[model samples]
Target: MTNTALDQALQTLERATSTPELVKATQALCALNDLEAAKPLVKVLGFNNPAVAAVATQGLIQLGRDTIPILLVSLDARNYGARAWVVKVIAALRDPRGLDLLEHALEADIAPSVRRSATRGLADLELSEDAAHDQLVRCFEGLLKAVRDDEWVVRYAAAYGLEQRLNSAAVSAHLAEQGRAALNQLASDAEGVRVVQLRALKALQRLNAG
Candidate 1:
């Protein structure tokens, strides 16, 4: 799509009411493959309507890593809703700094979802060394509780933490039963845990190379 066409689609996104129209607009923009489109798309971060925010978040994701810095900047938004979405965006980014920001948010942010995401992002990043073992243990304990959270995202993220930390055989075995259960649940159920769990499983699987 041309720049003019993409701009026209974005305008339609602004006025769109139905899901299909917004999807079409996003598809056009995504096909353009310009991450810069996500810069303006960040406005959707603050969109008053939840549905609009959801759509905008989807668009921002289609922009991929391009959205990470913008999402990180948005984490400081005064609005809790925006911050929560930014946490999700950062988790989606799952880049190196992604977990670092999450650690910062875990220590400093007030919102539960944001804190929750930070913990999960820490798991996703899988830090090395015993430097933060104290914090990791504490975070994993919290995730233990999260593994059963009514919120599926929270529950699986907790499990994902288990998946990432299996290198610490001591730590991995501590929750071995729960880890198996989570992966079992994921395989038995649908949509709750996916690649994060898979990645964690691979991490654990590799530690036995001895």
Candidate 2:
């Protein structure tokens, strides 16, 4: 928010022509969470500039749980990198509050990459609660939509989430059929996706076996 910080973020954005600068600036911006402090970086997400958008999202990851709500609600941002980064930012925050947003993005996002990233991030965060469990179950049931999604990337991600989160039978019973459907769908996809799906399916089988 201060002129100095704003200048710094602006400079960071300017310097993002290289990958290392992009990573550093993003990490620096994460430390500055004030909306004013973050807005310059956030605005870059909306830029017609893809490099700016990419760097800002990387910086957004440094934004902690306190910053996730802003990113999550920006679900309507037209920039693919912006939407994709919101998922990445939430996942980077890795907080309980983000679970619901991650679930929402996973199910409702129109972008295949955003949906896939959110589902994988949600699975990575391991949110646990009766409420989280139920929400995850609902997320799993709908994964069939992604499982059958025209994009193999989304299908594989949905399958991976189901496999990772089936930690309890309470949730597992509901997902068993859907998980199977995802696996079958995975099989029909490209070899790269089929490989990921097989790994995800193998994870599910291991969990079920245990």
Candidate 3:
């Protein structure tokens, strides 16, 4: 798109004072998907409008790792909505740079939704074969801890994350075994929610099949 078009979209986003205005502006900005739009798209996460935020989220994800620094700098602990949406974007991007943020969110964020996204993000992290052992351990331990989270939804995401990690080529055999044990425990957890149990069981089956 032309600089003029981008400038117009940015102006629209800046002047937006209503949902429709926000949606239309965000849609225009997202359509451009210019790196210049990254900061403004991130700002939309805190607008508390799901439709507009969804458009911005897709825009940021499309922008990919180029947006991580902006997303990281934009995180405001006091803004739960923004933090949650940021976690989701980080997760979707699966950049290794997000590891620390994802782990922190999983462990410390008060919002279960943020914790859940972080859990899944940990599993989705794209690590090199040469990635540090401690980093691998950190991811494993984080997911392991999340399996016991008070929120069932977080636990469910943990199960999925553990499964993904267990299946990753980067994971050590020892860690995979540990992950299997964790999934087995979750699968047989009679007191656990049926959906979680089933998900854990399915993860175990997939691991075994591979």
Candidate 4:
């Protein structure tokens, strides 16, 4: 939490107007890993410049769990891009406190990026041995719904998630079976895009190999 790097980065960010300069300052602030960088990075997520926003997202994620609370606050920002990137940051942190937020973002009215990221986040969840069976079932059901999502990217992410679920030692037999059924449906889906079908096929192969 040294002020030197944050102080310099803040000065640079304050003076930065161009995309490159903004991105540079954001990266610098992110590398500092100071709590002060959290709010700045969250604010940058709403930037009109995509490059700056993208770098801010990476920096915020690089800051790891320390950025979670600020990000959760930023989640309420009006910008869709900011919300979507915050979903990704929250997912990367893997803290269960963000789970309800992610699930809520899966609504159809939300942006595709947000929904897709939330889907991937749900798929990445790891439950403890003592976790409730209903919780596991709910997660499994979420993934199943994701696999059937209208967006191909969402389905692709879900297919990859199925592979992880089937391979996870923490997942229950019943949940694994559910994952298998979802993958099977995707693999045999005649109307599905070729790339997605291929992903489903690969997931099935991995399941069989395991």
Q: Order of candidates by lDDT, top first?
A: 3, 4, 2, 1
Clashes of 1: 0
lDDT of 2 at 41: 64
Model 2 gets an lDDT of: 0.65
Q: Model 1, which residues run further than 4 Å from truth?
A: 17-27, 48-51, 126-160, 167-210
Q: What is the C-alpha RMSD of each candidate to the true structure, in Å?
A: 7.4, 4.2, 1.8, 2.2
Q: Model 3 reaches what TM-score against the true structure?
A: 0.91
The C-alpha lDDT values of all candidates are 0.62, 0.65, 0.88, 0.78
Task: Give the number of the best model, judged by TM-score.
Answer: 3
Task: Write the residue-wise lDDT of candidate 1 on 1-210 in tens digits.
Answer: 457866776787678667677555655665676776775556655555566567667766667776677666665457777777777777666665565577676666767677677667766653445545555565465555555555555555665666665545556455656655654554444535565456445544554462
For candidate 4, the lDDT comes to 0.78
Order of all candidates by TM-score, from best down to worst? 3, 4, 2, 1
Candidate 3 residue pairs in backbone clash? none
lDDT of 3 by residue, 1-210 (tens): 678988999898889899998999898898897988888888899888898889889889999898898888888778888888899999999888899899999989999989998998987887755776777788899999998899999989989999888876867888988898889988995536999999998998888899
Q: Deviation in angstroms for 139 in model 3?
A: 1.5
Relative to the true structure, candidate 4 reaches a TM of 0.88
Q: Look at candidate 2 and give me any clashing residue pairs.
A: 26-59, 30-62
The estimated TM-scores of all candidates read 0.58, 0.70, 0.91, 0.88
Error of 1 at 99 (Å): 2.9
